[model samples]
Target: MAVTLRPEIAALPPYRQGRAADAAAFKLSSNENPRPTHPAILAAIAESHLNRYPEGAATALRTRLAERAGVSIDEVHVGAGSSSILYQLVQAAAGPGDEVVYAWRSFEAYPLMVTVAGATSVQVPNLPGGHHDLDAMAAAITDRTRVVVVCTPNNPTSTSVTAAQFSAFMAKVPATVLVILDEAYYEFDVDPQRVDGLTEIANYPNLVVLRTFSKAFGLAGLRVGWVVGASYILDAARSAAIPLAVTEPAQRSALTALDIETELLAGVDELIERRARVFAGLTAAGWTVPEPHGNFVWFAAGDQTSAVAEVLEEDGIIGRVFAGEGIRISIGEEGSVDPLLGSAARVVQTLPKAGENARLG
Candidate 1:
């Protein structure tokens, strides 16, 4: 007989990753940085000692990050990825009979992680403009709620929450509940008005800000991420984490990436410029693209999502497709711009109801 598994986990679908593209196509499905790993990061990785296990606390990296973030070392927690830390936080704080609230279609992993921790997920639908309805989210929180996630420049949508909006939302939330701000694409955000968690973190006793080295630093393969929050709250996440899961190479790379942030950030500036061009191109072509603040753009293709994705694929422009909802195309290599624009134009011209369907306006 088959061994029994928890009913929730048994019934849940496994996580689906973005589709990989062939040689001739642009892999814009994962929102990965198109540039190669910086030379300094590679050199740092080469210097790692493989014979021994990594530092469980990632002390050196944490020290560097704490110094930069203006937080105490004890207040910082590093994990294999931001997603890993997210899981640790959920498992640490929520369980059966507890509810974890977040915006729907924000991060695909939110629901999965909550279920694995034996917590119920309460997903608030995104506003029509593809932004979070912070007021709605605040109202969704009940006494049963333990954790609430706020993903700025939310994944698959690329829309952000303003600092004022977040401040107002926070005012409505109880200090007893934990708020996790997942800023996976923080580096790409150029909005001066957006919430800077590092600057605002000091005000909240129950808030934890999650950031990743994956998108900006080109460390997706290494899987290093960190959190800044109350020491006690982070201690709980640490308790839930697997020991030494963060490898030596990852720590070294993150440290080196920090050291050479200026150089890496220059590449980010270029991606921002590319994003502007793509946004303008799609708008000119009569598609209503949201103002993307992340390293990707969203097309709210609705029922035409699959058809639009097919058009993009045929043009060798592969994007992350959410059938019946939308498509998210990452800002990829410089050469991908024209092909993506061309494909988007084709979708608008060929499909009826394209204007109404291409945006959740």
Candidate 2:
């Protein structure tokens, strides 16, 4: 007989990573930084001693981040990735019968993490234009709600919540509920009006901000991320984290990445420019894309998702597809721009409804 598993766990599908591309294709499926890894980070990684376990606490990195964010050392916690911290936070705050609320189609990992922690997921539907309806999310919270996640420049959709919207939402939320602001793509957002989690974290005692080195720092392979919040809440997350999951190489690399951040952020500026071009190109092609604040664009193809994905793949552009939902194409190398736009234009012409559904309500 098969080993018995919790029915919910048994029924859940394993997480699917972005499709790998062949030599000719641009891998825009995972919103990775297209730039080459910086020499400094590589040198730092090379210096790691494999025989020793990583410093379990990642104290040095935490200290640096705390100083940078103007928080106490205990206020910051590091994990394998922001995703890992997310799972830890979920497990720390919620359990069976409790609810973890977030906007639908925000981060694919949110529901999975909630389920793994035995908590119910409360997904608030996004408003038209792929943005979170913060008011609705606030209203969804009940006495059973333990945590609420807000993903800015939300993954896949590439839309953001403004400062005013967030401030208003926070006002409506109860002080007892935990609010996690997932800002994994923070560096790519150029909007002056976008909510800056670090700047806002101090105001809310229950708020925690998550960020990662994966996107703008060109450190996706390193798998290091951090959070800034009240020491007690972060202490709970720490209690839930797997021991020594942050490797020495990852920690050292992140420290080096921080050292040369100015140089790294210059690359982020280029990606921002490329994002603008891709957004403009898609719009010109008659696909109504949400104004992208992340380093990617969303094609809300709805039922045409698979067909549009096929066309993109035929043109050597591999993007993440959510079957009937939509396709999320990351802004990649400069060379990918023309081919991506060409494929998008073809989809608009051949699949008229795809273009129509791409528009927000």
Candidate 3:
């Protein structure tokens, strides 16, 4: 007989990663920095001593991040990636009979993470234009709610939560409920009014802000990320984390990336400019995409998502497709712009515009 397993765990599907692209296609399915890795990071990785275990706590990296954020070393926690810290925090804060609240269509991993922790997910629907409806999310909280995640420039939609909106939402949350501000795309966001989690973290005892080297630093292969918050809360998350998960090479490369942050951020600025062009191109193509504040744009193709995605692939563009929902195209290499726009325009001309497949109003 098969070994007994938790019914909930058995029913859950494995996490889906962005599809790989062929030699001829541009892989915009994953929102990755399209820049080549800096020489400094490569040199740092070469210096790692593979024979020894990584500093279990990632002390040097945490110390540097603490100084940068103006927090104590104890307040900074390192993980394999921001997603790892997210799972750790959820496991630390919630369990069976508890609930984790977040906006629907924000991050694709939210429901999966919560369910894996044996917690129920309370997902509030997004606003008309793909932005988080903070008011509705705050109202969804209850006594059983142990954690709330706010993903600005939310994944798959690329819409952000404004500073004013977040402050108002926080006012309604009980001090006991933990709030995780996931800022994986912070460097690409140009909105002056967007919620700056590090700036606001000091104001809330229950808040934890997650940042990653994977995106802006072009360290997706290295997989280093961190969280800044109260020492006690982070301690709990640290306890839940897998030991030695943050490798020596990952930590060293992250430190080198920070050493040359200005140079790395210049690349981010270029992607931001490219994102603007993609948005304008999609609009001109008769697709009403939401105003993207991240390194990606959302095409609300609704039921026509698969067909539109196929058209994109035909034109050498590969993007994250949420079947029956929408398509998320990441800002990619400079040469990808023309093919992306051409594909989008052709889809608009060829497909039947109905339901959410038409212009968002």
Candidate 4:
């Protein structure tokens, strides 16, 4: 006899992560905020109990998040990270034999998470401009569809579908299907129009908005994220969540971080500027990069993405290479980006002065 795991689980692709370690690594594979956590948050977490059980209800953190999010405390649900709660959302909201639709190349996690819940995934292909094709996504939905994920400023692509488009899609889509808007990199932008979809959730009962402290708050290691929804939907997630999934220190840190939102957003301003600088820098360097509203940049360099990444990795600056599809590089702290920029300059300088035939890898 032999032991075997679920075929779908065994067949699932591994979750891709940003490289965050190395002596000289400015490893920006993960879309992490380069800024360190707020000192107040650090102090609060340190002062909190190490052995006590975290509030299973996550009441205080929920209250703070609700105040900041302009929603009721009951409308908020905290998790170890938005990613974790999203996993729970899929399981609780969707089921086997159901289909989950999302944009291909959106968040790499959507498909895997959907499959883990025993649902099939339908990833609508990206539009020509690298944005999610909401029209196609909405049309792809069928009665069997249970949830649809919309990752704005979509993960590897670093592009977003506009609010108008999202509104149109939301209008036509059946209210029975849950629409999860995963805004993992929400705080690092100045584009009011594109990211303003947060408030739009109020109108749709099926809306589930996901956010995290991992980006602007620099709390990736702490893993604090939450869901904003109608009290009914959030209550469902609350009841379904693994008991006390959030740690006390992480919740305390998230609360302290919320109190200093202004300072944190100010740092976000600098990060946005640096992202623009890097975008301009790449464009001036004669590359075909996309306009990104997130904290990172991606370009369609064909096979050269791997080449650029290899040269960067050799220089001890690890970047994410999508192989033939393209490459994504993140904007971190000033000191962090300096080394990355240096390596990038060399990778660009040494490559063939022409097409994607040049292999820097």
Candidate 5:
């Protein structure tokens, strides 16, 4: 007989990643920085000592992140990736019978992590404009709510929560409940009114902000990320983390990325420009996409998502598609712009409802 497993765990689907493209196709499915990794970062990774185990506490890197974030060393925690940090924090703050709240159609990993922690998930659906309904999320919180995740420039949508809206949302949250602001795309955000987690952290004792080198730093392959929060809360996450999961090479690469952040940010500036181009191009083509503050654009294709995605694939453009919901196309290489726009225009011509006149459910 098969070994018995928890019914919830058994029924849960494995996390699905963005589709990968073959040769001749632009892999715009994942929101990866299309820019090549900096030479300095590559050199730093090459210098890592493979003979010994990595520092379990990730002291050197944590020190660098803490200093940069203006937090005490104890308040900064590093993990394999920001997703890993999220998992650690979720497991640390919640367990069976507790509720972990976040916006629906947000990060795909949020529910999985909550389930893995044996906690209940409370997902408030996004508004028609693809922004979080902060008031509803706050209202969903109960005495059993142990954690609330706020993802800015939410994955798959690229819509952000403004600073004013976030402040109002925080006012309704109980002081005892932990709040995690997942800012994996923080470096790519261009909106002046967007929620600034680094600055907001000081106002809320229960708040933690998560960021990753995976996007703007072009270090997705290195898999390094960090969180800033109260020392004791971060200590709890650190306690649950897999020891030394932040490998030496990843640590070295992150340190070097920080050192050359000026150059990396210059590259990010280019992607930001590309994002603007993508937005304008899509809009002019009759597609109604939300103003993308992150590195990707969202197409609310509704029932036409798969058909539209197939059209993109035919034109050598591969974007992340959510069946019956929408498509998220990342801002990729300069060469991808024309094909992406071409495919999008075709979709608009063939299905007008997926464009400017579309009604979102």
Candidate 6:
């Protein structure tokens, strides 16, 4: 009585996204903008006349994104979200026996999406400081490796690989191998040495940079994202996407978000301020919280992780509890920081100055 499912999907673990509990919980688990969308963005989405289908090619959004990104419309390809674009990229480029290489604890999407495309998932382990070991990842690339994903200011860990480090990694990669730079949280990351993929694209034709409206732009509900790559590859990724996937509301909302980007960036700056505050707060609280460049901080409590997550859940402050080491706490409004720090303090308050062994099983 066994139903036959595809080997790849059957073997793969389902992707777990961060979700908020009931309304009473402060949903810092998902790395999303805690603030609401700008008034302009809301107005545009509301003003969208939806009877007609969205632009098949998303020309307007593409043009606007091009202007913002300092590229031509041809250089920009708008997709549903970075997640949608990433999945489509796998559909377009990966296949059975092909290999997809990315850091182990980078974006969890890498392995799940790659396997969905019938490709082998090669997990290049992180470096000693929980950063991507570019040298090792580059060395993992074999003839079978078709794609490489780089998640800068990487999720959960908040570590980013440098431009110089990745440039060296890309140099070792075959010119035919495509490199996808995931910059979902770029706006909040203020690392001077961080790798901005826009600067690297001119150097590598195979380089593709993925950006999203979800995180910094506060349009996660609208599902707007885009990719910048060579015209052919961009076209191919577009071709692989679900046709007419970008809706009228999505296009207008994203453009509206751009209109108020000045204001939105102000919010980002606030988040940056809070990012520093939380990092310093956790450090002072006797927690081993990593200095994440993104909108969250990681509490790597080693053996004590499970107990912390349990305590957090009990306190109704949900965060991502990774395997026995890292727990992600998203940064929000200035008013929101104290409650989060309080929730964390409540847990750390009781521990016997010893790390807990915990995981999200």
Backbone atom clashes (below 3 Å) for every candidate: 0, 0, 0, 3, 0, 7
Candidate 5 lDDT, tens digit per residue, 1-361?
9999999999999998788999899999999999887889879878989998998888999999989989899999999999999999999999999999999889889999999999999999999868898999999999999999999989989999889999999999999999999999988888889999999999999999999999999988878989999999998998999888999999999988888889999999999999999889888887777889899998888877888888889999999988888888999999999999998899888877666433442
User: Alpha carbon lDDT of residue 326, candidate 3?
Assistant: 90
Report the C-alpha displacement of residue 309, candidate 1, in angstroms. Answer: 0.8
Candidate 3 TM-score over all chains jointly = 0.98
lDDT of each: 0.92, 0.93, 0.92, 0.79, 0.91, 0.82
Q: Tell me the lDDT of model 1 at 146.
A: 97
Q: In model 2, which regions exceed 4 Å deviation?
A: none
Better of 4 and 6 by lDDT: 6
CA RMSD per model (angstroms): 0.9, 0.8, 1.1, 2.6, 1.2, 2.6
Q: What is the per-residue lDDT of model 3 for residues 201-277, given as tens digits with 9 covering 90 to 100?
A: 98999999999999999999989999999999999999999999999999999999999999999999999998899
Model 6: per-residue lDDT, tens digit, 27-117?
7788888887677877888888889889879898899878777888899988888999999887788899999999978777788888888
Where's the lowest-lDDT run of ten residues in candidate 3?
352-361
Q: Number of the top candidate by lDDT?
A: 2
Worst 10 residues of 5 by lDDT: 352-361
Candidate 2 per-residue lDDT, tens place, 1-361, comes to: 9999999988888889899999999999999999998888889989999999999999999999999999999999999989999999999999999999999988898888999999999999998889999999999999999999999999989999899999999999999999999999999888999999999998999999999999989889989999999999999999999999999999999999989999999999999988888889888888888899998998899998999999999999999999898999999999999999999999989988888887641
Provide the TM-score for each candidate, comma-separated: 0.98, 0.99, 0.98, 0.93, 0.98, 0.94
Cα shift from native, residue 303, model 2 (Å): 0.7
Off by over 4 Å in 5: 356-361
> Best to worst by lDDT, what's the order?
2, 1, 3, 5, 6, 4
* lDDT of candidate 1 at residue 291, scale 0 to 100: 95
Clashing pairs in 4: 18-29, 18-30, 307-361
